[model samples]
Target: MCEEATVSLADVVQEDEQLQEEASAVLAGSDSERCSYPQGYVKRQALYACNTCTPKGGQAAGVCLACSYKCHEGHQLFELYTKRNFRCDCGNGKFADAPCKLFHAKDDVNGLNKYSHNFFGEYCTCRRPYPDPEDQEDDEMIQCVLCEDWLHGRHLGCDVPDHVESWEMICEACMNTHAFLWRYAARLAGKRRENVLRDLTDPPASDPVPGAAVESDAAKETTADETDGATEPSRKRVCPEEAEAKPGCGLEALQNAGAERPGSGAVFWPPGWRSRLCRCDACQASLAAAGLSFLPDESDTVLAYEKKGRSEEGGAPGHDPLMSALDNLSRVQQLEIIHGYNDMKSELKDFLQGFVAEGKVVTSADIRQFFERQQSRKRRRADDRFHCA
Candidate 1:
C-alpha cells in the first residue's frame, strides 16, 4: 500500500523559517521603497529587467529594486540578481510609456551599466529561462562572480565541485578575456578546472604545467614532483624563496606566454584567491587595460553589498519569538495557540483592508484604537455571560 507523507509541526515551522531566510538573502541588497537612480552607479545592488518595456531582441535594460516595485508593478520582470556598478534604467528613454513614480528626473541613458542575455529573460549557455520547459534534468545554475551571468552546471564545461559555497566561480568567457587569471589558477583554484586548462594547453609533452607555482617560504627550487599533476623525469623550476618577492618573478615568467587556450573551462577559485592575486605595477596596468580595476576590491563583491544591506536593515531576525514560546506547550496546546494566532492574523488583515480600500494611511494611534476596541468587545461578552449565570 502507498503511504502518505507526514510532516510534524516542528518540521513545518522549520521549513517556513528556511524559506524566509532564503527570501531575505535574495533581497538583502535591494531597496524596495526608495528609487536608486540618485545613487548613480551603485557598486552592487539587486537588479531586475522589465520585459514589458524592453522585450527580447530590443535594447537591453535593467532597473533598480524600487523601480521594479513602484514603476514596473504588474509588468513582467526578470530578476538579474546582484549586478556590479549598475544604475537604474527605468523610464530613461527605455520605457516611453512608463514614467517612474518614485523618481522623476533621469538621464537619457546610463552609459556605465552593462547588459547581458539575462536582461531579456534568458540565461545559461543554452540561453533558456529559469525553470525552462524544454529542460528535463534538475540541474542547478550558478552565477559567475566576474560576469554576473548565471550558467547551468552542465554548460560550465567542467564537473561542479563539492562544497561550492567555499569558492567563487569565474566562467570560461571571463577567464579567457582576463587570461592572467589562468596564471594563478594552478596555485589558487580547484584541480578540476586547472586540469582542463592543462589538457587544452598541452604543455611540451611531460613538461611541468605552465603557470603552476610552488607555494613556499624557504624553498628556493621546486621539482616537477612538487607541482600538481606533474610526472616523473622531473624538471627543476627556480622561483623566488620569499613569497613577497615572487609576484614579479611569477608574472615575468609568463610575460612571453602565448595566447590563452580557449575552452579552458570555468574555474572555481578558493577563498582568499582575490587577495593572493599579483598587485604589482605591471599587473595593475594590465588589470586597468582590461577594465577590471574592481577585481581586487572586496567592496565590489556582491557579498559585501548584501552585508551592507543587512546591516542597514538591522539584520534578519535570529529567531521568531512566537515559535520559541510555542515550543514550551504540548502539541494540542500548540495547535490551539496557532489556530488563535491565525484567526487574529486573518481578522487583522481584513480590518486593514477596509482602510486600504478607502486609501487611508494606518497610524500607530489607529492600531492602539483597534486593540482597545477588541478589549471592549471581550468585556461586553464577559458581562453578558455573567448576567446569564
Candidate 2:
C-alpha cells in the first residue's frame, strides 16, 4: 500500500507540472498551433481586467495585473492561436493585451533609445533638438552678456508675456555689481544726511551773531567764570548711570576727582589690608627717598618701582623693554609671533635664523640659559631692594 501511494503522488505532481506549463503558454500567447478555449471554459486565468475596466483608464493598466482579481465576464475567450494578440470577448466588451511590437513588428525601436518613448510617455534624452527661432510657439533663448551662455528669455527676468525678436541676457556677476553700487550710493547718501544733521545741531564757538550784546555779554561772563573756577580747582566729571553700571568706574572716578581737588594733594593708594600693600608710584618714590631699596613682595609694587625709576631716568615707563624685544626680533620672527604656531616645524626655522642673528651661539641650551640668567638677576635685585627697604 505504501509503494502504490508513492507512485500515485508522483503521478499527481507530474500532472500539476504539465497544467502549469499549459497555463503559462496560454498567458504568454505562445502556442500558435493550439486553439483558444471555448466560451464556457476559462482560457488564461483572469489575473487582471483590461485598462478600460479601471477608473485610472490606461494610466494604471500596467499595475492592474499585480492585483489578485478576476473579471466577472464568465470566461469567454477569443482565439489567440495566431501571430496577432488575442482579445477577451465578454459582457463588458472585447479587451486586448498590449501589443508586443518586438515580436510582431519588423523595425521596432527599443524603449532604451533616446528618441523612443517609455511604457509611459516621458521623454528620456540628454539633448533635445532646439526649436526654430521663427516659430510662434518656440521659446526665445537669450545669451548672457558676460558668459555668453544661452538662457530662456523668461529665465533672464524679462517682463514680456510673449517671445520678442531681440532679447538680451546679463550674467549674475554684472547684476551683482549694479546691485552693490546702488546700495553703496544709498548708504553714502544716508551718511551725508546724518553729517548735515550733526553739523546743524552743533555750531562752532566762534559763530556769534553781530550786534547782539545779550549773547556776547553772556558768553564773556561764562568764560570769566570758567577761568576763575579753573584757578580754584578742577572737578571730576562722572555720569551717574555709567558709574553705577560699570564695576570699578565709580571708585576710579572718585579717586580721579580727589586727585584733582586743590587741598587734597594727598596721593591716592589702591585699597588693601596690610601697610606693605601700597603699590603706587608716589608711595614707591617715598619709600625710595627714605633709604628703602628692597623690592616689594607684590608684583604691583615691583612694577610701580620700575615705572618710577624709568620715569626719573627720562625714559618712557613700560616702553623700553617691549620695544627692545620687538626690535631684536627679525621680520620673519615677528610674522611667526603674529601668526602663531600652526606649523611649528616651519616657524622653528625662522626662529633659529633670528636666534643666530643676535650675535650669540644658537643652541637650545644657550637660549634656555640666557633667559634663566635674566630671571635670576631680576629676582636677586627685587629681593635685595625688599630687604633694604
Candidate 3:
C-alpha cells in the first residue's frame, strides 16, 4: 500500500471500537430476537423503514428492530435511529407482499403514531436523503424534540450551540406551533445573546411611562446599570411573588402580563429545563390539549433514551472479539492467529472498499469468496517457497 493508503493498526482498532459503541448506544434498548409489537406504542425504541415495502410517496411505515431482522431481512431498510410513542408497522397492511413473521396479528394502523419525510429517507428543510449522494457537505443533523424530525444545523434558522449533547432543540416550526413555550423560554433561551434578551426583559428606566405594567418577581433582578441610575418606585403586583412560589403561576402571569413573545427562531434548552415547566392544573391541561404532555417528561429526550440503551448493554465501551477467541489458544497458535489477522486486514479492507465506494451491499457469498482467495494465495506462496528450497 502507498504511504497515504496505509493505516495504523491502533487507529483501525480504535475506529472499529468507536463504531461498535455507537451501534450499541443506538440498538441496546431494542430486542432483535422478539417482536416489539406486543409492547403497544412503545415510549421509545430503535426503528427502521423498509424502502422495498413502503416505497417513497406511498404510505409511510416503520418497523421495530426485531421485525426488521425477522420479517424484512433482505429488504432495503433505513435506520431511523430512535422514535417516541411508536408502534411497529411491519405487517399491518403496509407491506403488500410481506407479513411479519414475528408478529402476525397487529392493528391495521397505530392511530397515535406520526410519520414524517424521514420515514421515507428524507430529512431537513432541504428534504434531502441522509448520506446524500449528490451533496458533499458533512454537516451534522439535529433532531427536533417536539416533531422528531432531523434537520441540518445550518438550516435550523439559529446557531447550534457547542456541546450539542448537553442541550435539546425545538425547531422553528414546532416553536411557532407551541408558541406558549416562548413564555418559559426567557429562563433558558438566548444564553448566547443574553445581553439582547436582557434589553427586552429589562427595559431602561425613563420618566415612568404612565401606567407601565408591574414587573414580575419571576423576572431577573436588575443591576444598578440596568436601572439607568434611577430607582423606579416599587409598584405592587398580585402574582409577581406568587409566580415563583406557585407551580403554574409564572405561565399564568405571562398570560395576564401580556409580555411580548420572543422573536422567531429555534430554541435550545439546557438540561433539566423540563423541571422548570409549570405543572399546575391549568398548565397541565394546556399541555395535554396541545398533545405535548411529554414536555415535562425527562425520559422523553433522545439523550435519555440513548442513556437507557447504554445502561441496558452494561455500559461497556466494547469487548474485543478477536482477543476473546485467542484466549483459549496456545502461545504459538495465538502468535500464528495474530500474524494471519495482520495479513488479512489490509487485503480484506481493500477488497471491501470497492463495494463500499460503489454503495453496493456485500453479501455472505462475497465474504466467503474473499477468504477462499486468501487461502489460495497462501497455498501458492507456500508452494513457491518449497520449490526454491
Candidate 4:
C-alpha cells in the first residue's frame, strides 16, 4: 500500500503565501511611525508576522496588533515592521523591531508557569520578577542512580529529607548484582531440593553384604568343575592385598546372578531413579567415556515407565501397555504424547510413508531447509502481489 495519499506540494505553498501576505500587511509600518498605547495598557487582539521578519523564525507574535496586552513580551514573536516604536506600556518597553524574548523565557521555565501573562505573581500584571533559583533547584533536581536521568525531585518516590549525612546511591551495577544474587539463590534452592529427594530414595550404603545367595545346585556344579580341572581351576582369589591373583570367585558369582535375573521382572525400588540418574551429567560423561550413548529405544522405554508410574500413583489400576510404550519415549517421541498413543502411531506411519515416497531421511537439517524454503516462497508471493497491485 502507498504510505501517503497523493497531494501536490504546490497547493500548500500557495496557501502559505496568501497567509504570509495578510500577516505582513497587518504588521507593516516603520518602527518610528508605529501605533502606541497608554501606560499599563494591554492589547485586545494578538499580533502576528511572517517567519521572514521574526528573529527566531516564528509566524506569529504573542502581543496583539489591536491592543496593548503584552502577549508576545516573553515569547519569540515575529518582529513588528512599524516605523514608530510599538512599546508595551505593561512596562517592558518597546520591542517592535527587536527579536522577542518571550520564547526564550518560555524555554527557561519549560512553559509550566504563566510568566508572560501574570508577570511572576498571582494575577498581577504590574509586577515583573523572575522565579527564585533556590526554589527551582530544590523542586526540580533528582538524580536517577540507574539511568542517570534527572527528574523533578517531587516526582521521585523517595522524598528528600531535611538533612542527609551520607546518601548511598544504588547504581545500575549494584541493582544487577542484587538481581543475579536472587537468581543464583533460586537455582541453588532447586538443586538442594533435588538432592534431598535423591537422598531420601537411595540411602547411603552401610555395609556391603553380598547380594542373594546362589542355589545349592549351582554351588555343587561349580565345585565339581573345579575338581575336574587339571590344575584345580586356579582357585586363588584376588584379595585387596594380592598383586597377581586371579579374578575373584565372588565377581564371577555376581555376574552369573545378574545374568540369571529376568530382565522384564527387574524393578527399580523408588522408580524414576533410573531416568534421573541416566540424564545426570556424571552418568552421561561416564557413558560417553565407555563409548555408549542413549539410544531411541532406551529413551522410549524410560519415558514409558515414567508415565506408567505417574498413572499408577494417580489412582489408575494395573499397568497400561499403551502407557508403558510411552514411558520409553525419546525427546522426539515425547512430543507425540499430546496426541495419545494411537494417534501418534498413525501420524508416525504417515510421516514414514512420506519419507519413503520422497526417498529422504527426515532429519533436523531437512526440517530447517524446508522452513527456510517456505519463508523464501512467502516473500516471493508477497512481492508478486505488491507488484500486481
Per lDDT, the best of the predicted structures is: 3
Hey, what RMSD does candidate 1 come out at? 12.7
lDDT tens digits, residue span 96-155, model 1:
877788888998889988889999988987889987898999988898988888999989
Which residue segments of model 2 deviate by more than 4 Å?
Answer: 1-7, 28-69, 73-389
lDDT of 2 at 384: 100
Error of 1 at 80 (Å): 0.9
RMSD of each: 12.7, 44.5, 10.8, 37.9
- Please provide, for model 3 over 339-363, each residue's C-alpha lDDT reduced to its tens digit, 9 standing for 90 to 100: 8887799888888777766656666
* Candidate lDDT (C-alpha), each: 0.70, 0.31, 0.74, 0.32
Clashes of each: 0, 5, 0, 38
Candidate 4, position 293, lDDT: 40
Better of 1 and 3 by TM-score: 3
Q: What overall lDDT, based on C-alpha atoms, would model 1 receive against the true structure?
A: 0.70
Q: Name the lDDT of candidate 4.
A: 0.32
Q: Give residue 49's lDDT in candidate 2 (0 to 100).
A: 28
Give stretches of model 4 more than 4 Å off.
28-87, 90-389
Candidate 4 lDDT, 256-312, residue by residue in tens: 434232212101111121222222344345545543342101222222323333344
